[model samples]
Target chain A: MSLLSVRSLRVTYGGIEAVRGIDLDVAEGELVALIGANGAGKTTTLKALSGMVRPAGGRVTYKGIDVTGMASHHLIRQGIALVPEGRGVFARLTVEENLAMGAYTRNDPPGVSADLDRVFELFPRLSERRAQVAGTLSGGEQQMLAIGRAMMSRPRLMLLDEPSMGLAPLMVQKIFEVIQSISAQGVTILLVEQNALLALEAANRGYVMESGAITMEDAASALLESPQVREAYLGQ
Target chain B: MDIFLQQIINGLTLGSVYAIVALGYTMVYGIVQLINFAHGEVVMVGAMVALWVITALAGSGTTLPPLVIVLIGTLCAIPACMAVGYAMERIAYRPLRNAPRLAPLITAIGISIILQHLAMLIWSRNPLAFPQIISNPVFHLGGATISGVQIAIISLSLLMMAALTLLVYRTKLGVAMRATSENPEIAGLMGIDVNRVISITFVIGAALAAVAGVMVGTYYGIAHYTMGALLGMKAFSAAVLGGIGNLAGAMLGGMLLGVVEALGTGYIGNLTDLCHVSWISSDLAERCAVDGHVILFGSNYQDVFAFVVLILVLVFRPSGLLGERVSDRA
Candidate 1:
């Protein structure tokens, strides 16, 4: 059985249908990438799965429990964390406060402390600037803080949306490395990226989304080698 | 010098009242961005209730201890105002949360009107007299005359403000409030019940307003139905002067406004009269000055000061004295 499964998920904003009947499954410890161009409903898909946007149709099941229409807060407690698009860091808050906010639902004080240490260890840059307000951080540091914040939640399944949206090439590489490291630590990852080449390279499995639907799915390596995927998304 | 000292004390005590009420406005605005027009009514209700309770005690021809009267009045106001505040948030504010911002503003205005009339209905149009126990003793400090009521009101209000600061900065609820204010969606995702937090904020704010109401009642020796309107407008000005969402700014703004009002009454009075003499064809500047009555912006200038401060703050520094830089629309 898949660790997380989303079936026939449809999300609509007003009359515009953004994500139309998309199904996905991620096995335990799998690094699954959802790659598409802008407006292809990549962010909407991740949002639906994390309960940020209530699905208009179908179910999102995590470890066999349907979380459709469940409050996003409840889903977080159930161990699904989404590092939202644009890296929504609280600008007024310190990096430390942002991390503590991620652990807001957790009651185990020692575990929260342990997770904070781990996040700092994962991104030493964050530790150095933990006292600084997040708004003052460079874009790359904010992205790292966003990911670090998600990590602080100790999610069983982590959803990352456009983690490399506005980063230097070196920073993008660093972010992918962090994603890989997070996956290695036994957390399932669902990464959405517009940078298809980098995302497909980093992911174990890749799903190609287009116009609010899953157009293709295969092993990341196979998609990287596929003529259609390479021509359309990989910019080959 | 003695007169100057006297005016300063008067200013400080009055300013203390404005500051206390302004803190409530700032706290509510900080988290919810709702003007909470009913907030002033909350103050009015508190004062009226305290007055009625005091009057009842006094009407029986048995005098309660001064300390006990003050204490009961204060204690009664806090919980009563808190309940009203919580009910307002839950019934009126919460349902309109997802609605357009203007909807809540309109609702709050409506609530304010309701509360004003509610106070009038309960207390009648007459000004309720405070028990004379509050003004029993007048202490002389150097050359300035200081009353016990003034000292209690000023010191107690400051104590409440300090306690509020501590609660906001140090407690778990404060953390939750900060989180909700920063980002409600993210805060909810973190299991901070956003609505519950908002309600708690209202309760806390109202409790502070009640404390202010009790203080104002004791010091002024009267409570009237229309009192909240003037106090509300002044507190709102204080909130703006301090920067709307900034907590410490509200307190500062309140005290500053109090001082300014006192100084205006004392020194600026003659200066402003000079303006009246120089600039105005008595008809024009007088019209623009406070009320159109007698002197010093006529006698109604006090009512206009709050609004003048509000306009000036908005025009000069839109972000306020301590601006919270909100995220710009992408």
Candidate 2:
């Protein structure tokens, strides 16, 4: 059974279908990448899965429980966490407060404190600026805070959307390394990115989406080697 | 000097009530941009409910203490207003969340009217005397005097404001509310129920409104259906003056508006008396005469000062004194 499964999930904005009947699966502890062009419904799929947007059609089952159209907060408690694009850190809140909000549903104070310390350990830069408002942080630092905030949920499955966007090459490398390390620690991840080369490198398996549909699915290396993928996404 | 001190004390007491009411207006407006015009009516409902409870308790001739009776009445008002606030959000505004912005604004006015009429039907159209349930002992402070009710109103309002500050900045719910206010969709991504946060904001504001209701009724010695209309407008003005979306702004706006209106009403006749225009007709000049002035407008024009200040604020500083919080774009 997959840790996260999407079967023919469809999401529409007004009249236009953003995510049209897409099927996706991420096995437990597996790092899967969903790579596509902009406007290919990658973000919409994640939105529907996290219940940010109501699905126009389809079903989503997480950990064998059908969670289609469940609200985001409930999904979050069910151990599904999404680090949204554009680094959706609470800009007005301090870095520390932003991280505390991540563990909003948890009641175990000691466990939450432990997780906070772990997040600080993972992103030492965040630790130094814990008192500063997130809006004041540099782009790379905000991205780091967003990821670290998600980690505070102690999620079983993580959905990361374009963590590399608007970041420098060095920061992107650092973010991907963190992604791989988090995956190595036995967290199932569904990574959506425009940078297919980097995404495929970090992923165990990969699916290529084009025009709201999955056009290719294979092992990460196989997708990397495919001439079509190399032309369309790899920019080679 | 004594008059000035007394007016200041009076202004502060009134300011406390305005601040409490303004919080409701600013908080709901802050989160969803809905003015929640019905919020004032909730304050009225709170006062009316308290009066009804007090009237009933007195009619039964129970041996309960006067303070205990007033306390019970106040306790009843809180939940009643909270329910009113909740229903306004859930039924009147929530369904129209995605509708045109004008729809909610218009709906708020409609709800305000409906609540006013409902109160008229439930209670009386004319002002009813709010019983003097407490022995309001006046205490001298410097040259100014502070009554027991005034002290209670000021202290209670300050306490609520402090609690609100703690709630907004200190609690998990507070962070969630701020996040929702900043970006509802992203807050949802962070596992916040934006709708719930908005509802809670309305409820908290309503609770404050209820307390203000009791305070106003006690202060004025009357519980009238229309009282909330003017009071609500003044509070709204205060919120705008303090920068509508900022919590501290609402508090500051409210207190300032109250004090300004009080002082304006207290001295407007005298201030107008100072204006000596020699060229004016004797009849009109008498109204603004140099020495022996005809009292053109006295404290009876208390309501006018709030609107005048409001006009001045809108014309010069539309963002408000604290400046409208430029929260990041959703």
Worst 10 residues of 1 chain A by lDDT: A46-55
Clashing pairs in 2: none
| Tens digits of per-residue lDDT for model 2, B1-330 | 478888888999999999999999988887997787778899999999999998899779899999999999999999999999999999989999999888998999999999999999989789999988889998898887889999899999999999999999998999899988888887876778888999999999999999899999999899999888889999999988898888899899988988898889889888765345544676666555545665568778889988998999888888888864543322
Candidate 2 wrong stretches, greater than 4 Å:
B278-291, B324-330
The stretch of ten residues in a row with the least summed lDDT in candidate 2 chain B is B321-330
Assess candidate 2 and give its TM-score to the true structure.
0.96
Worst 10 contiguous positions by lDDT, candidate 1 chain B? B291-300
User: Which runs of model 1 end up more than 4 angstroms from their true locations?
Assistant: B56-64, B134-136, B272-300, B324-330
RMSD per model, one decimal: 4.1, 2.2
Q: What is the lDDT of candidate 2?
A: 0.90
Error of 2 at B222 (Å): 0.7
- Error at B161, model 2, angstroms: 0.8
Which candidate gets the maximum TM-score versus the true structure?
A: 2
